[model samples]
Target: MGMEIPDPISIESVGTWSDEVDVVVIGAGMAGVSAALEARASGASVLVLDSGGRLTCTSAMAGGHFYLGGGTEVQQATGWDDSPEAMADYLGLMSPECDPAKISAYAEDGVEHFRWLESLGFEFNRSFYPEKAVVQPGVEGLSFTGNEKCLDVAEVVKPTPRGHKVPVPGDTGGAGLVVGLALDKLDALGVEVRWETGATAMVVDGDQVVGVTWKNYDHTGAIRARSVIVAAGGFVLNRAMLEEHAPDLLAVESNGMALGNTHDDGLGIRMGQSVGGVADYLDKVFVTGPFYPPGEALRGIVVNKLGKRFVNEDSYHSRTSAFVFEQPDREGYLILDSATMVQPSYRFQPLVDGWDTIEEMEQGLGIPAGALAETMAAYDEAAARGEDPEFHKAPEYLVPLDQGPWGAYDLTPGKCFYAGFSCGGLRVTVDGQLLRADGSVVRGVYAAGACASNIAVDGKGYASGIQLGEASYFGRRAGRRATAEVAQR
Candidate 1:
């Protein structure tokens, strides 16, 4: 008699054979959700799983800005002229080492992805500018084609105001909106969702990936699939992974809360590695510096080990802040005052997670007793005389740090609580195919979002929500491609 195929596995098959599907998505963040929705839309059965108790991950905690050009409906109505070439040029300038071809593909198809999202009940504010427009200031330059002034037709890009923010209040609005919309769509499309399900490994049959072995809060099991999409996010929270992947960023306190839930620990990347998937962008990880504790906010200046300011603080906002962790001494401090911290003039808050009193904060951050006073006196003296004696910070951005019992946080050049460390990840083609170590495509596997290598376009983390945009774009592309492949087979 022929070998038995075994009865169809049930959903409760923990540590045993489980039911199968057309596709198994390893994350539920923007990329995973997008992949599931697209795969289902393309008529393939999909099972999207996440280790987080909740459905959303750091993606829900993002600023929610999607980069697009070619005069979106809102841009066109507002008379803002933007094109694919212009957007690509801006990305090239931001990341000169990036593959122009991939960046160009992102720019060219980003509009369509935005429109696709709109079709899925996702609403955009259409702010009439790019989110990280500051990457491309007022200047006419050549396009990726080396044609001088070819992108002159595009409008000026600002650091802010290029992308739309989620109308919902608070930081999570964007992530909530996108993930909510995608989840609703997936539900309507009948896609299966298994939350609190941690993927432990990929089950490969020869050269083909057959499925994934996952451990849920209840038990462990496996879900077979024709293809797998690894959207499990980057390794910002895995201290060991951070040390291994980016040792320079181990000291900074990561803005993990800023990204929402902290389950984005590169589980998918690790699992992919187990199944012969080669991880890329390990050396291209980004680093961030520490923000001034309560009283500095965006007005504070970050000084290096020698007590000197190093970068255009205003320009490098969130992305390059990781670099502070790479300092030789990995020690630096932010100089600011109580007035600035209390009021706040920029996007970042002076006191992260709220500690009210300097004493309380000092207790947690371990600042020397008198150091706060000395730093304050120095900053106050400079601010009172219309100068930054220590760091030469711009007068407008300078706020005196002379309030009672000033606060200081002993910060190293490691990942900050407000910033993550994984910047570059697995490299992928514009079409979302995971690449091999030799820069070739890995069949039956794809990557999207921060988990994939992104330094090609966003070398410095230009804005808050651009990465999510790329995630959504590539996630959808991967979903569609996987669906097509399954259908053909």
Candidate 2:
């Protein structure tokens, strides 16, 4: 087993401080950097300590999408009139367990947040990619990266594109660009960033958090600060934490495949918990079996071990993936025919095998001989009539798979590349103030990014860009709020 979760150290024991800052932020990813920048901009001396070198964060490896809405310039340029209320309606449905205040704040402040990011040198094209895709193949500025366009979600609110991609070529790079630009801004502002330094414990004085203890190699020290913002990333890389919180994700081989980096080992979260920071949703996780990019593959149907359709293939990949995990033994297969089966553009879902007939495919899949045939016949009949009453797949993708050479794509967690990360962490208020189990705020400490459970709580309701978007936006909130406290002091 790993080392036991540490308790917060009382400040009375640590008599000397090697350094002092008005605000100290842990982690240098989007959240941490945003917090540092906001605090410094608010005229508070700021310091950032990261366990890893620059650009080594999971944010750097992302596709660079930001889940922005509420009349962003890009949305206006693309002829879509999105409102904060509409965006909130969609997001609230996506993460129903999230604090409504946080959801409302994100939605209401989204467009301004977009402008804030742009002010930091982030860029978005004035174009849009109108497709059901994991990410825009190239930078098209905006796209539908969530379930907003799905039949059920659209019924709740007018469907509008909200996923704003940075104006960089390729699927990835937006994250790196955003992180790089934030770091550049931090450099220009003279905020000190200590890399390869980890926060070992939260130093407390009485009931309020006062600072953090740190360690670098053999050196051990602490920083005295009026306030601290814990923007440390999630705990996906920590196996023990995973087994304890989100054991279902442990089934997937995520040591190398997960979206998170090595620093996401739960220490930051544990640090918050050590200080009586309330953490909830520790079971929520985001797992994906990215089966699209060819887009046509979504035209196929996903079945379980009993050869029965389980989810609407048209839903977002993570949404569908959550359903896939609920199947017996977590067995899931994407059934397609010659006309719909194509090489996956993203290439995570692997093609199992092809058979000349549905009967042959069933035998290969090891299900009851007639199970797949009946399901295919029913699906073909509905497709021919341009109707999907069972799962409500959009009519555009409702093409019959009557062509010969039927096949399956293995979506079983271990069989296919299912990547996942933890969604739960310390609980915080809308303004980024850490909360206790009884909902009282923890003074002198704030949290943002993955360390704090903002929005984006459930995998079934998750969108593509919510993690980065919420991290940066809430990071700013936490930083600004923490610095405002310094002024009050």
Total clashing pairs in model 2: 0
Q: For candidate 1, write residues 301-420 as lDDT tens digits.
A: 555545545543444444435445445565555544455543332323233333555445444444455444455567667777767644445455556655643433334432234444
List the candidates' TM-scores in order. Answer: 0.72, 0.97
Error of 1 at 481 (Å): 1.4
**RMSD for each model, in Å, please?**
9.1, 1.4
TM-score of 2: 0.97
Q: Give me the runs in candidate 1 sitting further than 4 Å from their true place.
A: 1-17, 126-161, 253-262, 283-309, 326-328, 331-418, 455-461
Among these predictions, the greatest TM-score belongs to 2
Q: Residue 294 in candidate 2 has what lDDT?
A: 77
lDDT of 2 by residue, 1-489 (tens): 243578888989998998999999999999999999999989999999998999888889888889999999999999999899999999988888888999999999999999999999857999989977888888799999988877767777898888888877777877999999999999999998899999998889999999999998899999999999998898888888887789878978842266788888888788888778878898988988788877888889999989999888889989998999889999999888988877777677778999999888999999898998899899999999998888888888899989989989888887788888899989999878988898898899999898889898968998888999999999999999999999998
Q: Relative to the true structure, how large is the alpha-carbon lDDT of every model?
A: 0.60, 0.88
Candidate 1: residue 150 Cα off by (Å)? 21
